[model samples]
Target chain A: MLLIALALLQTTPVAVAAAEEPIAPYAQSNANAGAKPFESDGMWRAFHGREGVDRIVDGLVERSLVDPRISDTFKGHDMVRLRRVLKEQFCHLLGGGCAYSGRTMKDSHKDMGLQTADMGALVENLQAEMNEEGVPFFAQNRLLAKLAPMKRDVVER
Target chain B: MRIFLIMLAALVASPAAASDWRGDGKLVLTDGITTVEGAAGGGIATWAVIAGNETERGVGATAHASHVALPDFDLEAYGGAVGLFDRVELSYTRQSFDTRGLGAALGLGRGFTFQQDVFGAKVKLFGDAVWDQDRVLPQVSIGVQHKRANRGAVIAAVGGADDQGTDYYVSATKLFLAQSLLVSGTVRLTEANQLGLLGHGGDKGDDHTAQFEGSAAVLLTRKLAVGGEFRTKPDRLSFAQEDDAYDVFAAWSVHRHVTLTAAYADLGDIATVKNQRGLFVQLQAGF
Candidate 1:
């Protein structure tokens, strides 16, 4: 009787494992499928309503225009269109109800001769802008963390 | 020495003219405290991070004073370092080792002192400890230190072959920003006895041997870090058994220009003194 009970216990876990394993992936896929698009969140609304992101984009453009290290990269570019595209890109990244229609990070920065120092300057400017916009440090870090993966695509030199 | 002074002058002069210096400005606690040998690292190890606030385009310098008091001995060191373009570091340090009880035991009278000057240079090989977060690579550097001891007569009497020698090392440092952790490892090829205070190459052997040093730290805040370090030493002198050194240290970056560090160090045996342990304190100021 003891042996039979032991055998049942061993088989029961296997049965339970089989039953539980499939549901996890299924639930994960369902969650991914049901994820809301970026435009519906309160955080996104707050960010866009205050024009916080626009201010940040404006700050970046202004700094880059004068920065000796990176000013030449923007000499021939269209400033007004670039500003709009940057706003759209930042808004999309921050979960605002917008989609980015501009070039991918790699394509946009390709052949730009961007060095690590240039990237560092851009980040420094963005951080200053975030501080000026009264964004909390944690929030600033969150945005940086999200954007950090783009370094591989953006840095060519 | 004249070149070092000129470099120091350059370091002190540059920050005054360039007020817009950027490029991370030395990540918090990533610039390890200056070591006794005048390298940027923990108590006894050399880390891969560059010495000062200098980034890719600017220059920075730091001056440090350190004191270590043991049961039978005491050590005092003063030094300064300059970093250029965050790529190369040049440092000069002078150390005074006071053999109190051990000197008397050796019949050399009490409070005998051994002094040495160390000139060091380090070059960054690759990677950035602070910003290369998305990857597993750590910052790596290679360094060399030329040491010349002052008490050549005493050193020669104690079985040392030379009063001067050089040590070479390679170091790697990594930081996990999310976890607030920093780690570093160094391998040195050295023949120094008592860090070249008692001089280099002894009766036991004269060939340089590889030694290991490592450090791990957890950041308590943006500017404070508490860590421990372990450094293995070569036992080249037959008269005394050299043992590994260890320290538990706390470093605080009080401001952009100053950092204070304190530690409890166990330097093992020095000149037949067993289990020599004591307090270590250092102050660093830089641009």
Candidate 2:
């Protein structure tokens, strides 16, 4: 009888172990019809799908009044370089990840003939625009910190 | 060695010792409001015309008093200033010029007194001395005053004609912090021989006498300042040869809105007259 019982247990294929198997709650939804694997973990999927970059880019285009020649030059030449400049400046100023990769500040403004009064006007314009965009004063000052040092380079007069 | 001692003696002496004139400070240009009385020393004279830098963009008010240290005469004066939005400053002053023994010489009463009132206004023009750290042109200001001689008969009888008119001028004030001093100078086109209402009146000339006014205030502590002022006057009116005015003064900022100023004043040449001494005390409050 013991021999017969052992044979039956082996054929039953570990019923206790089979009953204890863990079931994934989201497995069915994740497997359904080309669903992304990352969606299995809802947090990462939400971050990857966010539209932060697009909103900031649209804001820049709408608010900034670029010089016609400068805008045309940016549009005609390497879009990648122009995009990088915009992203880098905005990200650096607004406290984002991108590092500024451009000409040394002094080299960039070598022939600009910028004066203190001109700088002041620019600052005033920027402040007004930032205010319209609901940027807080504290954040504005933080952005100014990144640009103020360049005054020595930008202001030739 | 002798020159060094002379310089050392000059610093320790009283009025007319050393003439180290300077401006208030670079930071003072935010508004027309300025420290009351001289920035330092305990002698007597009103301080700078304006209060703060143009950046402050606020109104300011100040009052100052001082006494003169002339030979035998004594004088006392009270003055106040009102600055509007860093653009304009209107000032009013009342001065009492007393003659001790001089009154006897003039055949007046045993103790005669001359009094006057001054009304002043200042407007700013282009300059970067207040805001730009790298600029040399001090913030330039244009000012004018209507002098109304109070003792008309007394002044006319003593000095010939009591000229009452407007005294207009321009002033530039700059502060050199690295040197711990302030420098200011003014040019006035006027007929008044002296600042006194009893002196020669205004409507004097268009040539504008280049009267240099300067102050050297040492920053003893951040809140305490000690200094003196030397101002040259135009005696274009035949009544008197303008005697230079000088004072030793001290000022204290008790709080952000309040300041107390005290000084010993020596207003020179009252209608060809010299050596008028007096005491001045002033209280200034601002919003």
Best by TM-score: 1
Worst ten-residue run, lDDT, model 1 chain B? Answer: B20-29
What's the CA error at residue B96 for candidate 1, in Å?
1.1
TM-score of 2: 0.51
Question: What are the DockQ scores of the candidates, in order?
Answer: 0.08, 0.02
**Tens digit of lDDT per residue, candidate 2, span B1-287?**
24324323432331232132111111221222232221211232222345421122344444455455357666665565555445566666656667777788777766687666666777767553333334566767787777776677766664524546676777776544334455666666665655645555433432345566666564443345557777776655554565777766666666544556565667765655556655545555433
Q: Which candidate has the highest DockQ of all? A: 1
Q: Over the stretch B1-287, how does candidate 1's per-residue lDDT look in tens digits?
A: 67557756876787675665543355555678899999988878899988877677667777899999999889999888888778999999999998876788878888888999999999999987877766679999999999999999988988998999999999999877645678999999999998999888999999899999999998765568999999998888888899999999999999867899999999998788789999999999876
Query: Which ranges in model 1 have alpha carbons more than 4 Å from their true place?
Result: A1-157, B1-4, B17-24
| CAPRI docking class of candidate 2 | incorrect
Count of steric clashes across candidates, in order: 1, 53
Specify the CAPRI tier of model 1. Answer: incorrect
Lowest summed lDDT across 10 adjacent residues in model 2 chain B is found at B21-30
